[model samples]
Target: MAHPISFLKGVCCGAGLMYFMDPERGRRRRSLLRDQCVHYCHKATRAAEVVRRDAQNRLQGTVAEFRHAFQHDEPADDVLTARVRAKIGRYVSHPSAIDVDASGGRITMFGSVLARELDGLLAAVRSVRGVGEVQSALRVHDDAGATPDLQGGVERRGERYDLMQEYWSPTSRSVLGAAGLGLMATCLGRRTPSSMLLGTLGLMLTSRAMTNLDTFKLLGLGGRRRGINVQTGLVINAPIEKVFELLSDPQNYSRLSDSIESVEDLGDGRYHKTVRLPGGAEAMLSERIVSVQPNELVRWRSEPDSFVPYAGAAWFNKLDDNRTEVQVCMSYNPPGGVFSHLAASAAHMNPKMLMDEVLMRTKQHLEGSQPSREEGGERTGAAASTGGHPAGSEPQGSPRVEGASSPAQAGEPVIHNL
Candidate 1:
């Protein structure tokens, strides 16, 4: 059998040709209807794609905005909930309901929240890192106000919330997690049914117990003391020595990082540096050069405060040609260990995520031409100390290194074999 679409296209083309050849009004009229239908279908498909893309973009933005608004609160209840409700209300055919419970610290909504909209809501709810759960007791409704009666039903709906009750339900997460562990154990078949069941139950209990234990011990955890470490490569078109020279100069840091406000060389390879934060807060950080071996390696330790302790080090390995691999590693002990971990989870502060950013900027700095740099004029004190003794060579019992470098000194940038 012939393809129906192909046959229709052929018939339309033949009829068009016959009309043009004979100048018959009837033939032309038939051709025009077919052409119009095809054109309209194409336009409809394009329109649908545009609508889909726009919807996706809006959803992503909503999720991001909601997450930003609720990053810290548990069972978050704030303007974000209202904002989301408004956004969702726009799409639903029903008037939405939002209930904010300050006493219980929860936000609940109901009334015609669709399946697709659930993702945005869930994402917003989960963005609050410590949020225990997101209870989506939302339902979809099809009542759209006035019928544009083409094919689908028109209905309006909304959602309901219970602020007094917990927004997150741990029971559901536990069940799913336990099920996953049980399935894994069954596939392994390492033990008898009774033993397997007991083991799985024990695992689940242990997991929950550990989480509870952490919750109790949050304040004592060394979360604030520990920090993240990152390493990234920067390949300069110039010689490795040139790159090392530029890196060793404390004044160049501002060029490497837009965040650096100033660099005061103290002597040796150390400097007192100031950095501007996102909200215009200037942080005066005491950074000591822990190690410096010409262009081979340079490491530093930064303690923003007595509580925010972090150490970062990097080793420069020169690959053949102009490329260099800078290996960076950081160690941090967050304050209060696990207890204050939640407080430190915010971006621009987290050790792990911050390390990534540092690496990325480091790469950008070395790769790009020097931008603006603060004056690294004369030092009021002795030569700024190096970041610390060259990494592995730091005396076992020596104090942690922190310092900056002067702008005048140029050093070779080659990895020296131990």
Candidate 2:
């Protein structure tokens, strides 16, 4: 999250670098400007202010002239760049990437920077007046040095999905409760005797547990949808390890996440992640690594009864040209019997949108990572290497993934028990 202001300041610094690096040009330019400033300064104590105002006023006209030249599509001047640079340099604290040349306006920046901040940059430039339109064919690089990580504030998108899910839980619970009451009444009406009632109660308990398990399975599936699950994906232009490094680091919560507070790796790829909710609520999720095949996939599951009933899994796949696709799936059973149902329902409604946020952020993180090709393309699973297969890899287990599937396919179907 590079601040537009900071970038503009950097642009000014870059100008200064160019100035000092070529002192002859700087000195010559300063000598000409110095004479004008001195003559104006002699008139009053506010001479510098007057001179600055005059320079700015003149620059405005020059900028307007450039705009006209562009509108008419006429040949522009090359000296305009130096002239405008010198003029604006005297008034503003720093110069932005809005440098001009005799031909047109030339801006030097990173592609990511342009992608992230071009709108703001353009807005600032437009305010300068005189500038008709920007003629930019600037080539931006993917520089590790220029990638600035902004502080993670509240994740409105994630929180919105979470809140919607939370609200849905109540509605779901009401439906289930009504369904349960109807079931119980029907059983009582049949009156198969006292023994039958006991059996019915036992069946209900088993059924409830199974239902909870079934919910978990849905959350663990890649891009799987349930009543309210929102699924989304993003592409990363870096290695999986690098993406994982940022995702695995709790400190990066401040850098990459909007609302995650902390994530403590609980050994064996299990983790305790605490995320902030909208309206100041906090959710503590206990997640276990249901499956982990480095550079390919990482899946986690957590039951509502254990530390946290909410479960989530992330999968990473490498694509061509150093790009990677990451997907996240999460499901949660709300807390408290009735409230839990509402929450669960809410989780179902927009699982795709929430998951989309995870993927997009992951993409941004990976694309912004240090550029260096890893030694290997993908990591082979230990289970596959050994005489073992993922939990659901066998035909007798869950269905096989079509092709180039990660080990996560095994953990998906089992997410929902009942």
Candidate 3:
């Protein structure tokens, strides 16, 4: 089966090359190839520069470490402790909250502090003189309140999403995109079946990389989401009211995703939804509409009885009389820990993909187009509602209410499962 698929793909590529290299169109194709080559070359140069700089920094650090070890013995216990404390204090805004202790070249940090502050505190302590090992006994806290365990470390709500974005930022995309393009160009220039096969692989990679979609999880280049946040957006050629109406109905969900087996309305803006996962497994969720501003915004959160804790919001902006931009954002903590996150990320089954497909289907359905098989049929019930403006009116802006998650920005990468 795999061999046949590979053969067909090769044949398709050969045919595409013959067409693109036709006498009349060959010049244009050649020009495109040249442009792509130049673009990729520049990207390669930038990447090389980054690598060189990083290598130099690492080398310098190593040299400095060796020099220090040779020149000075470990400092006295009290002196080392003072130095470690000062180092930790410099990195944190609220040093008073942190209590640092040093004994036998080991340092222990005890305090109630924000999660983001932990990494720096540990690093700083390790860099101090006479510090052999660092132990973090600190209690971490976020806006949500106190947390006792600091083992996995607490991350800010969207830290994973932010990291993923930085990883696949425009610059990173360009570099990968150029590599893909270069491969295709090489195949075209070579004009051989073997080259075509390689080009096909390149094309696949390029398509995935250029779209800001993280499809190469097997290679570990895919985005990572943390602490339950997913944001995605799409533009629709319909008024805000019509789009909002379509999304508010729970029935439309099945049309967007086949995974959604059923949605049951539980009244008072609450719903019980059953979902079929990839392996015939099923999970149920209880959700309630927390906020609604007609045609402008809608938000929902998981009920206490839900398996996964989650919150989400959608925002509608009128781009024009015939076009509206819709944004959806979701944040959830998956049931299991790191292993579950790895599985979901590797499978590309994260919430960002879910919202992406949903928004795409919503666009298609509202525009009277048939939803793709990859996307499913519409399910029924209202998931959320906002009470601000009428359709097509200028939104006063999202409400100042507490607990409302922000809508996903277009092309923003979100962490999933983590």
Q: Indicate which candidate wins on TM-score.
A: 3
Please tell me which model should have the higher TM-score, number 1 or number 2.
1
Q: Which portions of model 1 miss their true places by more than 4 Å? A: 1-238, 268-270, 303-307, 334-418
True-structure Cα RMSD, model 2: 30.1
**Which 10 consecutive positions of candidate 1 have the poorest summed lDDT?**
409-418
Candidate 2, superposed: residue stretches over 4 Å from native: 1-228, 248-251, 303-307, 336-354, 368-418
Task: For model 1, state the Cα shift of residue 98 in Å.
Answer: 72
Report the C-alpha lDDT of model 2 over 1-418, residue by residue, as the tens digit.
6599999999999987787557567776576558657854774345334446655776797798877666743224545444444443333222343345444444222222233334444444443323445544433323324433322222221113311342223223334445656666666667677646755664453334324333333233322222222234567787766765544333343233234455665566555655544345555655555666677765656633343344456667778657777776554433332233334334321223334333455554454532232454432211100001012112232212111111111111111211
Per-residue alpha-carbon lDDT of model 1 for 1-418, expressed as tens digits?
Answer: 5699999999999986786666557675576568768976996576456546655776798799787675655444555455555654434433333332322334455434444445655565544334444555565434333433212423423343321221212332334446656755664676777767767665544343223323222233443422322233434454567556655545544433334455665666555665444345554556667677897877776544423455666666778667766565555444453323334343223333333333344444555533343465432211111122112222333322222232211111111110
Worst 10 residues of 2 by lDDT: 383-392
Candidate No. with top lDDT: 3
TM-score of each: 0.33, 0.31, 0.41
lDDT, each prediction: 0.45, 0.42, 0.60
The TM-score that candidate 2 achieves is 0.31
| Best-to-worst ranking by TM-score | 3, 1, 2
Residue 313 in candidate 3, Cα distance off native in Å = 1.3
